[model samples]
Target: MDLIDFSAIATEHATRLKAIDPLLPPPGELPDDQGVLTAEASGSAALGVLSCEKTPADAPGAQWRALVEHRLDLRLAGPDPGTALGLLLEKWQERLAESGTERGDWETAAVVIRPSRDSTGSGELLRHGFAPVRVVAVRPAERHGRGPRRTPGVAVRTATRKDVGNVVELLLELQHYDAQFGVATVRESTERALTAEVEEVLAKDEPLLWIAEVYGKALGVARVQLPPASDWSKIYVDQSGRPKLGYLTSLNVAEQARGTGVGTALAEHAHQVFDTEGVDLALLHHALANPRSTPFWYAQGYRPLWTYWYRRPAVR
Candidate 1:
């Protein structure tokens, strides 16, 4: 299919998606000259778009590495869309090999899909070996009223140089919890890297690191950062035209303190800080399969905005 055809199909997909999630952003129009693969059948079509980008490695605290990201947009008017999807994937893999991606330079392959309840695309993705990894959730900061009352005896305060050791410990605990979802792995050097990250955040003015403590013993930690001006200004804003995006990067409480009010106190504290900074929207990602996170975040008033599906084929 040509750009004209691709644009028409993409527009239709966007319309259907907006009916489901009104907050969904408009899809970008493809350039006629850009290379995009297309699979066609009688009365049906699928578009495959490929791009390679650098991202943080899978190992906890590892540096950035290259990866291939594929996006499949399907609009099937026929009886079977799965066949079109399968053909798209086959051609996508072939293109990757041709682009030197199969030489083991890329760490992984990722995809993004917005599948509704009756979306056939969901089953097709799983059948092709993709697994859901991260869920991007959003909540109107305006709705984030004063969170639960702060638990007595638990204090939330900014991290200091003296808290680096304790902060690293809490971060490692969080990483272990994340590993249960299979997207992350703990490494021997994680502590060292986490310590450096904590120090950096403490030194920065835009990103605030908060720690929850009881009697001077750290029990939980939360990291909140001001998003880039481009994203904050363009995508999320208030009536006054002020940027209103704050991202909660990581929040975790020690296993021993799970049931206690420590986690709630820490999260509420973060929200208080964001409110004070004039933020009107907050964003975060958690593993869809993480029982602890899935429930806790929803209870905190966040709703799913996007889902990232992942697949790692054996190095050829």
Candidate 2:
């Protein structure tokens, strides 16, 4: 393997990912249309390829992610995939050190892998200090069995501008809980950003924001995007062509409301609205290690599509 055979690489990678999880997106015509640092395994039974790319800090969702991200994609065939991965990472780090750009506490080295896959290269990733941080989970538009029953005394309704304060409060609570898991960073700007986000949604003609209330007290909130708004998330789904995509961007329940069905009411209400509007799928991101959300989401019919594994500061 003197030269990289990208065509052969794409087929193997796509086949493996699909086999691991049917929801994994189909591989592009090429490994990646954009240029990246490519490394191939040598003196190994497995043929492994790792392509590394940097996502600048200013990109969308950068606030939650680190200042800059060095994201890698791995493709492997043959036995000993872990050894090949180790070699690829070694080469990648060598190139990074040679580049001489500072690797600090603000940068991240990340990989998005399917969680359902075998443990072929996971140990190597962990040795490199990568931790599973986030998951892109999705629920179909069709109902599975009976939907959640409306919680007693909880009135789910569209949120108005007057409800912005309560919305921000609940959203912050959600972020703070996630921060403990290292997936969320509650910066000084988080509250301001969340407030602006809530206000913007409320201003929409038909906002997809909903609040679950008990005796006029807002105990839960669900922010979602329909159709054109959710098209950005369609990238995570397989290339089945765009069906009407809906995103469950944010969901939170107050501490006092947990296990009382407030979260379920809000979630099922969003699904009802999405289904009524003819959405094909509903997508959301949750911290993989968050015990509460992991099981909560699974019980709601959402399954993991992609898992983002990352090492902070882009180094050990």
Candidate 3:
């Protein structure tokens, strides 16, 4: 494909996406929207486009402290999707090598793939050392009834400043559980940082912090952010044109509280809050490798919208 043709294709892709959802954020103009690289084939043609952007070291909650992020969008038009993907991967590796001072110097690389209907490039991604790290799961905001019925002893209520310490502890416990799946590490600073975050949330009236208690002792915590008029709110709306959006940022239950219906109660309560606030959709992300979270969220009716594939080369 020539430069002009490639640019038109990229623009068309973005336009189609926006048309699907007018609120969708614009896919920023790529630096190399004009074809920087092309693939030769045995019988057909393929095109590969790569875009790089610098990611700040202190970007909040980033998985890695990478200096740059490379995004690869591969389009193949041939009978052999596998071969075309292989060619794209080869070109991607060459670009990475040329851009970095040495192999594995870059902190992180990623690609976004839709795996709902097809598995076209999944194998190629795995073969090239990418692992699925985060899955964006979403569900319509229809009421799932008030709260967990089975757990009669558990009570859910809005958290207060006095509950900050307990909430922080529950969050740390969650981090420890997440660490088992290699999603996060519980550092010494984690507690202090989390404490501050909880305190701040408690101070805010918009994003709610809820606690699940049994006999007046906190055993679970859930944080839900009401949609603000900004980018984060628009990202998770249901295609059915939800008037409002709600994000279930974090839900953590104490180890002993698992399987006892505490999590269900907490989640249902959050949903009730969303329903009361006129939210028509809810969104959350969980590590694909988290065995407990994976099933629990699916049971709650959340399905994956996008899967984030991550690659971090081992540094010296």
Estimate the TM-score of every prediction.
0.81, 0.87, 0.78
Residue 157, candidate 1: alpha-carbon lDDT: 85
Q: What is the per-residue lDDT of model 2 for residues 1-316, given as tens digits with 9 covering 90 to 100?
A: 3226666655666677778876567855443534444444443323333445554444435446665556565566544557777776676667655656466654555454544455667887787777778888888766452334556899999999999999999988988898877657777777887787788889988788998998888999998888777888878877565577789988889998887788888888888888898987788999989888888888888877778887766654
Which portions of model 3 miss their true places by more than 4 Å? 1-4, 7-31, 34-59, 62-70, 73-82, 101-118, 143-149, 205-207, 229-233, 236-243, 314-316
lDDT of 3 by residue, 1-316 (tens): 3323655545554555455544344444445546455554544334566666565443434332245556665544444555656666677777777665356654555453433323556787778887787677776765242223446688888898889889988988887777665346455556767777788888966548888998888999998888583237564443445467788889998998787789988888887887898877777878788888888888887777566676655211
10 residues in a row with least lDDT, candidate 2: 42-51
List per-prediction Cα lDDT, in the order shown. Answer: 0.66, 0.72, 0.66
Question: In TM-score terms, which candidate is top?
Answer: 2
lDDT for model 2, please. 0.72
| For every candidate, C-alpha RMSD to the true structure in Å | 4.2, 3.2, 4.3
Sort by TM-score, best first: what order? 2, 1, 3
Worst ten in a row by lDDT for model 3: 57-66
